[model samples]
Target chain A: MSLHKKILIVILVASAGAFLWMEQQQNNFTSGTDGQSASLPHPGHSAPDFTLEQLSGEGLVQLSEAAGNANGAVVYFWTSWCPFCSASMEAVENAHRVHGETIHLIGVNVTSQDSKQAAENFLKKHSITFPNVMDQDGAVADMYYVPPVPAVFFVDSGGTITSRKTGAVTTGELEQEISRLKEAD
Target chain B: MTEPFITWSVGPFTISAQMLFIFIAAAAGYGVMSLYLKKLHVENRGEILGTFLTSLIICAVIYKLWPFILDPQLLISPGNLLYFAGGPYAVYVSAGVAVIYFFLQSIRKKWSHHSLDSFMAAITTALIVFSLGVKNYGLPSPFSFGYMYEGVMYHAVNFYYSWLFLLVLLAALILVPSSKKYARSITMLTGLVIAYGLAAPFQV
Candidate 1:
C-alpha cells in the first residue's frame, strides 16, 4: 500500500477511537449526578469567607462575621446582566423584609461581567433593601465556586454551609432554605 | 486553582489566560514556520508573512461579522453584536477562509511543497500548545489520571489532545516523505477530523 493510503487508514482508526471515547465520556456525564450544581460547594463544607466593599458606600461586609452573628447568612452571587437575577432579587427582597432580623442576607454582585453602576441601578430598580457587596475582581464568586448567576449559599452561624441553590429561587424556597440554615445549629 | 480557566486582573483590565496563551502560541507558530521555510530553501519570506497577516485579518473580520450576518437583529446594538455573535462556528469559518486563501496563493504563485509542509507543521505546533492552555476537560473517570475541576472529575481531554497532536506532528515530520505532493493537506485533514471527533461530545 502507498504511504499516504496507510496514513489515511491510521487516521481513520484514530478518529474512530476518539469518537468512541467521547461517546463514553458523554454517557458518563449524563449518567452521573454532575448536573447544574456540580460546580458549587457542598453542604457541610465551611463557607469561603470574603470581605467585599458594600455597594451602598457602607464599610466592608465580611462573610465570617455575618455568619457568626445572625441565625444564618444567605450569601447570594448574582450579576446585573443575568435576567434570572432580576426576578430572584424580588423573591430575595421579600424574604429579607420578613426575615431581616433573623438572617444575614448579603448579595455579592459579580462585577466581572457587569459594571458597578449597572449593578447599583439594578438594585435601585428592584428596590432591594439588603446590603449588596461589589465583587469587583470576582474573587468571592470564585471562592464559592459559583457557576452561574442567581446562586445562593446558606451558611449556618458557624460558617459551615447548610445548603446551596443554583439559578433562581422562589420566596417559599428561600424561606425554607433560611429556616433549614437556622435549624442546623 | 483546579479549574481549567484563569482570569488575571492587570490594573483596570481583566485578561483571560487562555487568550494570552493563544497569542503566544500564534507568534511561536509563525516563527517556527519562518524557520521551516528557510530550512526548505523557500525564498520570499515576505510573501509568507503577507499571507499570514492577511489570513489573520480575514479570520478576525469573518469571526466578528459572521454572527451579524446570520442575525441582523444583533446589529441594532454594538453590545449585542459583540455578545451574541461568533463562537465555535467562527473558528470553522476562519479555517475555511485560510485554506481557500492558501490554495489560491499556491496556484497563483507556484509555491513549493516544502512551504505547505512548514505551514502544516506550524499549525500542528500551535494547536498542541493551544490545547494545553484551553479548557478541554473530558467526562468524569475513576482513574488516577483524571483531573478534578470545580467539584467534578474529568478525563483531562486537553492533555490527551496535546499528546495526540504531538504524535501527529511527529508523524508529519518523520513518516511523510518531504517530496510528497499534498502531504500537508492530507495530514491537516486527518488531524482536523480526529480533533473534531474528539471534541464533539464536549460541545455545549
Candidate 2:
C-alpha cells in the first residue's frame, strides 16, 4: 500500500528467507562445528576420554592411558607441513627442557605422513624432547571437532578441557591460557 | 547426521549478549517508524518499506566505516582484513553511500518527507544484515546467527532459528502503531542505537 508498508514487507521477507536457509542446513559436519565456535565457547560439559596409539619418539605409546603422569595433559594439533606449528613446538621443546617431568606436552599430528616424519625429525632436529603422537585417521581431531591445524586443548587434572586454542598460539599465550584454567583447579 | 547445538558459555553468562543487540536495533527502528508514519499521509506500504531499506543501508555503512576511519590499523593487518572489512566497516561504507545519495535527493528539493522515509528504510535493512553477519561468525548468532566454527563453515546451506524470532520482532515493530504521549520516532531510534552500542560488538 504505502511506501513504508512496502519496505516493511521486504524486510519481513528477507529475514524469513535467512531463517529458512539456516534451518535447512542442519545435518552437515565440515571443518568447524557449532559446538566449538570461534568466540571461545566451552569445551562442552563432558570431556571425552580417548586413548589413541601414539607413536612416541622412544617407542609407540598410548596417550590418555600413559601411566605415571602427575598433573594434567596438553594435547596440541599440528602437522609437520605447517612451519608455524613447528616453530611453536620449538618453544614447547624449550619448555620441555625446563619442565619435562612436571607437565605433559604432547603434539598430535593431523593426517599427514610427511609431517609425521618431519614432526619426529623436528623434535630430534630441534632436540624437542617431549612425546609426539601421530593422528592418522584424524580420530583425535574429530573428537575435539577442532577448527584448524595447531589447535591446543588444555585438560585439567580431573579431565575436563579447561581451555583450547584454534589457530597458531604463542608459547606465552599457551602458558597463560593453561594457567588461567588452573585457577579454578 | 546433524551436529548438536551445545550451550555456549562466556564469562559468567550463558545467554548471548548479541541477541540483546539485535533486539535493541529492532526496537529502535520500530520506534522510529511508528513516530514518522503515525498521521503522515503516505502512498502505501511499499514506499515506507523502500524508505526504511535505504536507511538500513545508511546505518550499516556508518557503523562499518567508523572504525576504519578512526583506526587504519584494522584494515592493514593481514588476518583482520577479511572479517574486519566484512563486519562494521562494510555497514559504514554502505551508509556513507546512502547518505550521499539521500543528500543529493534533498538538494534537488524533492519530496523531503518521502526521502526521509526512504532513508529510515535503508537503515533497517543494514541493521538486519550486519546483525546476521556477526552471528554467523559463531561469536553469537543474535538474528540469523548461524553458528559457524562450533563445527564447520558450511559451503552448502545451513541455517539458524534465531533469525525467525528477530524478523518477527522486527515485523511487529513495523506493523504495530503507537498511540498517545509517544516520543518522536527519531528520538526513540537514536536511543535504541545508543543502547545497542553499549552492548559492545567487540566485547565478545
Per-candidate TM vs. native? 0.56, 0.43
Give the alpha carbon lDDT tens digit for every residue of B1-204 in model 2: 123222235774432234345446555655545555544554443445454556555666555445455445544544433222222234446656766765565456454344354344434543553354333222233333334454434221112223333443355345544331222235335533542432323122
Candidate 1 segments whose C-alpha is farther than 4 A from its true place: A1-37, A40-108, A111-140, A143-185, B1-4, B67-88, B150-152, B195-204
Model 2 bad stretches (over 4 Å): A1-42, A57-71, A94-103, A145-147, B1-204
Each predicted complex: what DockQ? 0.09, 0.09
Query: What is model 2's native contact fraction?
Result: 0.11
In candidate 1, which residue pairs get closer than 3 Å at backbone N, Cα or C atoms, i.e. clash? none
Error of 1 at B55 (Å): 0.7
When summed lDDT is taken over every stretch of 10 residues in candidate 1 chain B, the lowest stretch is B79-88
State residue B80's C-alpha deviation in candidate 2, in Å.
14
